[model samples]
Target: MTGNPAHRRWLMLAIGTGGQTAMTTVLYGLPSLLPAFQREFGLSLAGAGALVSGPILGILLTMVGWGLVADRRGERFALAAGLLPAAAVLSVAAAVRGATALAVLLVLAGACGASVNSASGRLVIGWFPPHRRGIAMGVRQASQPLGVGLAAAVLPPLAEHAGLPAALGCCALLCAAVGGVVLLLAVDPPRPPETGTVRGPGPYRGGRLWRLHGAAALLCVPQFVVAGFALVFLTTARGWPAATAGTVLAVANLAGAGVRLLAGWWSDRVGSRLRPMRLLALATAAAVLLLALGAAAAPPLGTAALLLATALTVSTNGLHNTAVAEHAGPAWAGRALGVHGLGQHAAIVLVPPLTGALVTAHGFAPAYALAAVFPVAAAALLPGEPAAPAGETAAPSLDAASAAPRTPA
Candidate 1:
């Protein structure tokens, strides 16, 4: 629609993907390096795991606030203000002695990280046309694992070669750089959110939205389960060194990032969202079972294949959100995404501790059995491609020349 659209489009994608990586790198980076944290801080395994849990808890509680602020203030200001300061706070935490102080910093990092997501999701939707959004959004979602993967690869040595505090301080600086780039370089979508107070189908008024939310919550179990404990699984169950587990986990994540890009791209081309989700569900289920069987067998190659397969299984990331945005429309997009995210985070918060206990008491098999329940539930909730209210077709549309893109960070 303008001069040199291709170049500008790539620019936007970079900003979208880069911003996501900056925010999520903080999240994924910590888990891979937990062993180092445990040794230095003299933490129990559970205590070290809380380092991962703290930020997630903050994100779970504050997602709505992040979305609302982005909607009101524009993303650039909101993200810049939150992310830059968050980095500073995290750096300060690195220096402090008490566990309480570190936990507070993690929570703050999470809350600030939450602020970045809504804005970024909206940006991707706005930048890429509807048909290709799956791939683009996939890339956007892939940023989480990509950030984690990079951190897994780089952070430990940076810490060991340098120092833990110094390593974390580097992450803080990266966040600052990304924040500044977003504020200075990223372009806002031209339009505001839709005019009506009623977004899509007035979610709370009906059962359908809740059904979708429940499904999303169920689907989130696998993601959180892997994220919280994948490294632990490799280290404890398979007898790999914790460091080796971290490296392999990063490899799996890199594969996952590729999958996300492809999945999102395919969604954009295919009008119907449920088909891919259905396929993903089946594949993901198989991966879970395969991993479980491998663990039961306790073989080396089987475990490796399962880990790699897990990456492949999760490739179709965030397709559910694409379906929602298409069906629900931008009016309700932010809150709707947040509401669904609330369900996902609900799973994130509960699954880890519950499954961790299950692993301790019953074993990984029981924990995975419980984990397998989520994708099945998510698949069941796909809203059967219904007829929209009168003339409504769920594909995203700009209401005006300045119509803004919807985000689900």
Candidate 2:
């Protein structure tokens, strides 16, 4: 931070994105080992579904609590404290014998990880100025997919050799180690201008915030639905091996990582997040529709469509985050971003159990059909213009504040 802000900006980006990559790889990386989980537990698909649902439900319950803490305490403390316990929780996840204990461990892990997202987003936004924040956040968004890619490439082999529990334990240790590094290396960015004690305009004052909220909720459905079911669909329906499904998911994550950067860069150069958001939503809608059609079609065609949809559906992640960041401003950015995150977590929490039920009853086709509508509905609801194009986002340099919000290192 003492050096030029621009140079420091890249450092902050690396830490924030790096932490996201690690946490997501550990948290959401379970699908790659579903077959073994089923075999070991002697469980049905529905019973195994909780492995995905547990963490999300924890996230659902705790994100806003983290937001409030971020607003009051600061991102650095929130992140450090959050990461410290992750090792223990994940250790429990590794050692737990019963399904109930595993679910409880996952729920604790998810709740702990929830703080990482809010604290991390604040960290990135704290570092970059408004104009360049898109690309910064986009790169930050890439961390999730990057983590997934790492999991895909590493987890299968690791699980094959050491067993899933030991692999998870390894991941937990890595997260704690990285968390310590971030706590030491990452610094909050300087705020640009001074913010007075005056109350700034807030999202709660108008309908705009509500609109974005609804849109995020809708847009999140397709992404989460695809995430929840993609591997299962490929494995169960296409008759592909579990390893092959893991490979496809890995590939899909790589594609998603690329799109995250493109989406952010487009927002940076094109001068708006909303327009690109619409295009992304439309593409996601088309992708989801094609995905549904592909499900019933040839295996190869279905695979291609599913991969395409996975990339597009997940691609909007950065755009949506940046849009929410731009709208929320520095004053309530923590809370706004927390609420926005809440939307994603809510979908993640609700969708898996529902998807499992859907798969159990009417089957996956209807599930995909229902999931495809979410992004379309999101696209339909998006305004031609984002709420705060520029005026409201004015923020003081992070260094100037009594409590500077540190980006997650």
Candidate 3:
């Protein structure tokens, strides 16, 4: 449908948000279904943990490729290509008889679903001007927690009553529906005019991009640590009932979603993305440490700590994502976003099993304590200003512009 430019941009934002929510419902949703899988498959904590990480491992394999495709072919094509096939695979996966087969299919689905990660974000960057990007990206980032919250609220009981397949089938249906909407409505902004024949170094050659990618990866550890095990830890370690724990985590996810939007708006006000990200890293570290201490000393305190930590840890995502897109510039934004996605998904693949091992050996406290290190490292390691791409003017600062009133034209 045609509309005013501002309305069109917001529509694009809504579409991107919907697509991200659907994909992440299957991606982050896996953990909420893990307990059921553990029982059905007679799996240990680590094996069930593998089920949580398998799709991320698949995402790690293909994120960069999808980003490249988005750069060349546009966001709509990349997303449709990924989502439709991935949904089909996930739907078929639910019917598989063995956990091994299901895990394999989920991994394949993850590979396909990686299409949305870079493409959707790039769509936001393209459609919205720099002044509004932080808030737009924040709205986009909210989809993950929203998806996870949906899974937390709906999946466990559905799995308990109908079986794991039904829960999985629900995710697949949602993905398919979102895919159809994206294909019908997604429209990429016109490409900016190229300035010169001379080409600069690729995104991977830049130390700034690499640093951002690394920092994003490191910071993701705490988020994944909580997402992977929060419900299980609450039920098994703190002795809360499973349903009660699920509800708590769901509420935490909702709170985290709100924090993400706030963080994005805050970044816009601050005029620099990296500054807010570094601050968020410090907050995340403190939250993780508090969670560790609380888990050890008091169950009631620990539950509160868990929700606080979830909000702090997950809030940085939209800020970092907007930073990457801006730093990469219009030319390479898609591929750069892909590389960032690769790093984050790689962390997701590795963190669950490592944290699971720590939990099996010591407890949630040590695992969380170890997770605290990554955010501190991220804060320390994050780069200052990113270099602009060759021949391109720097984007205007939203915060600075908003502070000054415009004269009448």
Candidate 4:
């Protein structure tokens, strides 16, 4: 590796991002291949949904455990350990004939892949200085949308042209390649030298971290609602063609990725993640309510609002993730992030079924109105400008930090 401190940290960040992108492709992106899954396996819509959801279920169940591993073992080990096994499982999945077996394998892969959620964020927190951490984590957080975009572009067509097995194998190959990179090149971030003094209790002992978790989880409701229903609303309610709805949403998805980076830069500029998160929560509420109004009264207005809401709803994720890690301190960052991941994933999993019922009985406007409440509540729960989190001093100038020698992982 280069001896240059700045280059070294960024290189690690890039590896972490690639690792996460691969995992997200398998965990969340496989849904893009659902039609293929249905055709090949003769699955009903419900069954296909269940199959796709298997990985999420695995993630929820095991994220905390994986986080614990990252905390104790080191980020590089946690990432490679989880990812390589996940890749192996997917490789086996490519050959599996039974739907039940495939579902089981996907769940197992998800369980293993869950390591990236906490480990990558932990890695970011460890490597980057405080001021840059926001953008660093934002870049890390962009992996999800990037992975989904990659899947949308690559997986379905690959499955169509080649076969389902080929698509699964491709996901496996991505995972394995990234895993090998992490194992060979990635280093755990340097920790502060342990003074002989014993550390205090965990961050969760305070109400602040708990409240942050609650707010973030609540925020997830609106995000998933906007994401889950936007295309459906455009196609069914606005009477647009499916392809047109999809194109608009594809653009929105790309924009959403940029929104995360901007939010991170904003937080870095302001020097506080919580303040921006609180404000973004309020912004998201307004956007969602505007969407509700448009959904009820004006087709063109609703369309615009849908796109706005999609971007706004996702704006706070990197902010919250950064806040959680900083506050938790290095000692507990992994587990704290694990808890954070669990809450967000739980919300993501539940939004579809609950909101599907709401849209069914009441229609799009009411459902969006109800969804808007979550971010409003999140805004209420967020902590105002507070003291710096444990393990983080207010950042020195970037030049000063850059001149310091790189710490060994």
- Against the true structure, candidate 2 has what lDDT? 0.74
lDDT value for candidate 3?
A: 0.84
lDDT of 4 by residue, 1-409 (tens): 5576677888888988899999988887776665677788997534565777788888999999989999899999999999999999999999998899998999999999999999988887788877688888889887876776567667766787898999899999999999999988998877656788988877777588888899999998887678756655776689875445555666776777788899899889978788788888999999999999999999799999998887788888888988888777777889999999898888777565566667767889998999899998998998766654488654322221321234443
Candidates 2 and 4: which is better by lDDT? 4
Q: Give the higher-TM-score candidate: 2 or 4.
A: 2
Q: Write the per-residue lDDT of candidate 3 for residues 1-409, one digit (tens) a residue.
A: 6656567778888989999999998887788877898888998888888887878988999999999999899889998998899899989988987988988998998999999999999888787767678888999999999889888888898899898889889989998998999889988765665678887876555487789899999988899898879888888978887788788888889999999998888877866788888998999999889989988887778788888997888899998888888777777888989999998888778777777778998989999888999999999889875544587534432222221112221
Best by lDDT: 3
Q: Clashes in each model (backbone N, CA, C under 3 Å)? A: 15, 8, 0, 0
Which is the winner by lDDT between candidate 3 and candidate 4? 3
Ranking by TM-score: 3, 2, 1, 4
Q: Which ten residues in a row have the lowest lDDT in candidate 4?
A: 396-405
Q: How well does candidate 3 score on lDDT at residue 298?
A: 79
Rank the candidate models, highest lDDT first: 3, 4, 2, 1
Compared with the true structure, what per-residue lDDT tens digits does model 2 show for residues 234-254? 878888876777777888888
lDDT of 1 by residue, 1-409 (tens): 3445545556667887787788776755677666677777887666676776777787888887776776666666766876888788778967877778888888888877877667777666656556566776787888877887777767766767777787678778888888888877777555453577654445455565676677667776776666667766777877887567667777878988888777777766766566777778767766776666666665564476557654755665567765555444544555666666667676676555566666767666666656666687778776665454567665433232233333321
Q: Assess candidate 1 and give its lDDT.
A: 0.68
Residue 118 in model 4: lDDT: 91
Q: Residue 71 CA error for candidate 4 (Å)?
A: 1.4
Scored by Cα lDDT, where does model 4 land?
A: 0.82
C-alpha RMSD by candidate, in order? 3.8, 3.8, 3.7, 3.9
The lDDT for every candidate, in the order shown, is 0.68, 0.74, 0.84, 0.82
Is 1 or 3 the stronger prediction by lDDT?
Answer: 3
